[model samples]
Target: MSNALRVLMAQQNFLVGDIPGNTQKVIDGANQARMQQADVVMFPELALTGYPPEDLLLRPSLETRVGQALQRLCDEVRDIYLVVGYPRMRDGKLYNMAGVIHNGQLLGEYAKQCLPNYQVFDEKRYFSEGDQPLVVPINGVPVALTVCEDIWHPGPALQAREAGAQLMLNINASPFHIDKPRHRTELLRERARQAGCPILYVNMVGGQDELVFDGGSKVVDVAGELLFSGDHFQEADYLVEFDSASGRLSCAHPSEPHPTLEQSVYNALVLGVRDYVNKNGFKGVVLGLSGGIDSALTLAVAVDALGAERVEAVMMPFRYTSSMSLEDAEAEANTLGVQYDVISIEPMFDTFMGQLADQFEGTARDTTEENLQARCRGVLLMAISNKKGYLVLTTGNKSEMAVGYSTLYGDMAGGFDVLKDVPKTLVYRLSNYRNSISPVIPQRVIDRPPSAELAPDQTDQDSLPDYDVLDRILELYVECDYSADAIIAEGFDETDVKRVIWLVDINEYKRRQAPVGVRITQRGFGRDRRYPITSGWKAGV
Candidate 1:
């Protein structure tokens, strides 16, 4: 074999704030790398303390735990060059840092210079900026070290090259959003080509809250050609061999193909649901299956995530519920092999109507009555969730949630929303995509028109714009950050554009209180995009 400094990149899933467990993970990775005859074992950012420790960084025991964890690594890792990330406290200051250790000796530490403070990152709040550059020699090859955000700009890569480094190793905990993989590939190429050195980027995978880090770890050559890559949506340990003598890198496995549009979004939802339920210690998940595309898609995602035994679908039908809906809901449950139950809300609805009869003596029936129907279903789902210890999964999609189409304390009542970031138009696409895999969703469910069934005969279009048009407007206004006039200029109907903007603006309060969900897009509702709940600003076309 040619003389090469073998590097092992561990793309792992780390639970935030689990110092002991995370430390064990690092030890295991180092051992695996040694067994593979690696010279360096490189880990993702914050591999020791986990990424985005958030307020856990403020814990009184935070520094103590980090020190103990580092000591454990120093004592245990003796043969391989171990590069691991952890939060550092030095001179009464905290910095995002990575340490180089070998043969039970702490060689040096590299504090992260760039602390990202946008989207899902708030590194500035906890970490003081590190200005020094760290370059360590492994097998006589100078390998420069950098954190996640450092490589995003040009300074760190150039600095590493200027420091006489042969290759750069950057550790990351970067979360996934739509189109991010491609964007990252291009950005890494630009950086490598500019620095004139190969780069190995290791990213953590797994879901944390709304953030899902798709461990698409990769290594590119000096000319920016990809030499190695890993699969998406799984925690993987890829042993990549980089030849320092001949500048040739190789892997045993070819790069796994990137997922398609629907697959990518669906995988994000699955990972998000799985981690949220499992990490929070929920027994399972319970959700209302209204026989509509939104609920059907959510049910399928839940089953794919937690398995049929852990997911329960309750069809809370009302007087207006159709026979077709009942059949479709049952068919979906049977196809998915999930625990299914029927809970009729007619009696509950009558009781609530009876209780409010005196107060509603004069007002004619309107959204109030429709909202009551939704609330009745919500109450049933919540009660079952409480008794069974299953977290409630809300099925409202982005198109509905963006507008005032959803009722407060009604359909919005749930522990987590699986489709909070998914638009209504995408719900149908995802449903079809899931069916294509195993045909779990009923064909009729995908073909039928969507309705709330809260009224005698109600279609969503009667209350709001068509989903195709609504989703487009939402993408422009919400995701693209366009003004009313800007969207109208895109050739949308003036009236539809105005109404959609108005609804999204007025519904900010409801969304602020809504449950969190998976974020597949760059500008999802939670950390990525934030608007004032109460504002006097008006959009004009």
Candidate 2:
């Protein structure tokens, strides 16, 4: 019997609904792993069709396409055992499956035991739960197979141990959220200890709409010592050698230290924008740089993600726009080395006001005028997007999005929202974090109070609570599902709690129409949190 085994973890990014392309990726990955003399190569869950294929899983040809792709992998890949995830059909029900392929033959298949259905997962809508454990012998060592969610629970690992598995392999299409990596590490330690075998976990990477998968694929020894961790938010194959006699695993290097909160979130945003723009075949991205922190930070991220050459910054100044704004906007563009333009919205605003003069006869001017200014800028940016084929990026953050601080079809008229899930407080912190790396954002932008620049001498606090306080309340209410009284109990002012919750409830319609952005939280305003817009549900204890 062989005393040692080498396994390659194929941490890859995949395009959704592209069976043919994903199949080719698998074939190429397998061939590459073979060149490295790997005994087996493992891929992430749903590698054949990409994760969360959603309604695409309901397509009538899913089975046919999956079968064809699997056949191609078996035909084109040789010499190395390939462990990959795909959807399988049996007895008129679908299963999230992982199959073992060796030398042009299909060896064994394992259905995912735990189907996740909460918070962006709807596996129960399509896939039936797998009831049995799969143990396959690879190079004289008995290996256990489990899908993504299986390892989170104790039963799967315990069952594998009972099945006499010496090593465990878990493939995943897990998406990123704050603190997810740390949580995964802790869970891996628990699961490995339970299974009484070393565990090799592989995860997919890249941005898929609102979700970003940070590929921190890792391996843990039988005692739950993390041996290696791949880099976050990148695609690379890693080699790990397992010693059969000692029942342990070894890597050429040690585990990579976990990144700080700011570092991880920033990387997730960059990867999300990069994949979304490139994968969608956009010429580039353009955003309105109001000399404010949100847009300024967005600009930095765009340049970092797609390079300065592909990004364009437009400053649409109005009467309400300050001189500091104009100067800072230009300075930000210049610092990033991106194309910068100045387009005054004075004429458009005047024209719109003139046209609405009769309709607004004797009406006291309030937010309507402010909204019109924003609309003019949106029109210009959208026009440029149409003409140049550049995707328009919106710059609203989660705090504004929570309370309907954004004007619909005005600031929200864009293809993507870069900070859709980031709170205003986090916005300032992230801006500082980016500057710490290379100083792209202007210092004044981070230091100055945030404003929409649609009204004179206005700051965000004029309408909303302080961002630090607001963000904490939002975390408790929106993310934690706390009632108004519960948030008040958290030591926030009762008045502020009630007011914030009311705004959040009333602003559901606006958030519904906002562009999709990178989701970096446990409860972003995307698919992660779904609420009825017209519900009579009121804030209470």
Candidate 3:
């Protein structure tokens, strides 16, 4: 028996429905592994069809295409043992299966024993659970294979250990939430100790729609010690060397920690934008730069993701917009080196107000006038996006999104919301961080009072609490999932807690129509939180 075995973990990105493309990615990873003289190479979960193919698994032809792609990958990569994931249909039942191929043939296959069905996962809807565990021998080493959710359950790892498997390889397309890597490492360590096998955890790294997969793939020893970890939010192919005789495994060192939450969130948003644009073949991004922190931050992120030339920032100011706001926005665009346009909303606003003058006789101009300015800007931005083939990026932050502070079909009209999960406070922090790297956002933009400039002498403080207080309250209610009473019990002012919670609760309808954003928190307004828009149940504080 060989004393030493080498394994390669391919943390590559795959596009959904691109069967031929994904198959080539697997083949490329395997070829790279063979060039390095590795015995086996492992890919992420559903690599053959891309992770979370979502409802694509429902189509019969899609499943057939995935099956053929899997076979083709197996035939193409003959020198090295390859573990590839795909959806398989057998006996009129669908299963999430992993194929073990070697010497140009399929050696064995394993269905994912456990299916995740909660919080952005609907695996149970597409696949039936496997009752049996799979243990296959690869070059004298007994290898146990599992899909993404399978290792989360104790049964599979324990069963594989009982079956005398020497090592376990788990493939995942796990989505990124803040601090998810720490939790994953802790779980992998526990699984390693329980299974008494060096575990190789290979995870897909890229953005797929609302989901951002942080790579950070890792290997842990039998004693629950981390052997190596890959980079986060990036593609990586790492090699793990296992001494079968000594039962020891080691690899290259893990990457440096992400500098800050803002940096991490920034990278996730950039990757999300890049993938969504490039994968979908969009030319660029267009956004209404309101000279506010939200749009400034969005522009910085867009410039980073699509390059300055591909991003266009437009200042659509209304009559109430301050001169300082225009200057600051122009400065930011200049710093970013992107194309900037000034399309004043005065003409459009005049047309709308002229149309509404008769209806406005009884109703003293309240939010209607404010909304007119926003709608005009939205129309002009959409016009540019429609004509220029650029995806419009909405700049609303989570705090505004939580409270319906943004106008639906106005500033909210866009192909993506870059800061949808980020709060107003974090928006400021990230803006400062971006400026620190290269003072792109004017200092005045970060320091000045935030406003929609929809009305005379308007400020965000008029409607919402100070961002510091609002963000704390939101963090408690949204992220911690605390009731108003629970938040008050945590020593917050009862009225403050109730008001914030009430806003979040009342604004569900608006959020439902908002564009998707990169989710950096545990409870983003996206798929993570699914409150009913018409719910009467509020936490009575």
Best model number under lDDT? 2
| lDDT (10s digit) by residue, model 3, range 1-541 | 5567899999999998888999998888899999989999999998888877988889869867976887687678878889988889878889899889998788888999899887788888899988787899887889999888877778999999999989999999899887788888889999988888989999998888888998889888999987777788889889888888889777855545543676777788889889988888889999998888889989999999989989999999877888998998898899889999999889878887788788887778789778878888888889888999999999999999988999988989888998898888888888888877887888888888999998999999998888998998899888887788888887888878888788888889999999988888878887788889887796764
lDDT of each: 0.89, 0.93, 0.87
Predicted model with the maximum TM-score: 2
Q: What is candidate 1's CA lDDT for residue 501? A: 95
TM-score, cand. 2 vs. native = 0.99
Q: In model 3, which runs have C-alpha deviations exceeding 4 angstroms? A: 252-255
* Residue pairs whose backbone atoms clash in candidate 1: none
Query: C-alpha displacement of 133 in model 2, angstroms?
Result: 0.7
Q: Which ten residues in a row have the lowest lDDT in candidate 3?
A: 252-261
Ranking by TM-score: 2, 1, 3
Candidate 3: RMSD over Cα atoms?
A: 1.6
Question: Model 3 Cα displacement at 112 (Å)?
Answer: 1.3
**lDDT tens readout by residue for model 1, 262-305:** 88889989999999899889999999998888999999999999
Root-mean-square deviation of each candidate, in angstroms?
1.4, 0.8, 1.6
* TM-score for each candidate, following the candidate numbering: 0.98, 0.99, 0.96
TM-score quality measure for candidate 1: 0.98
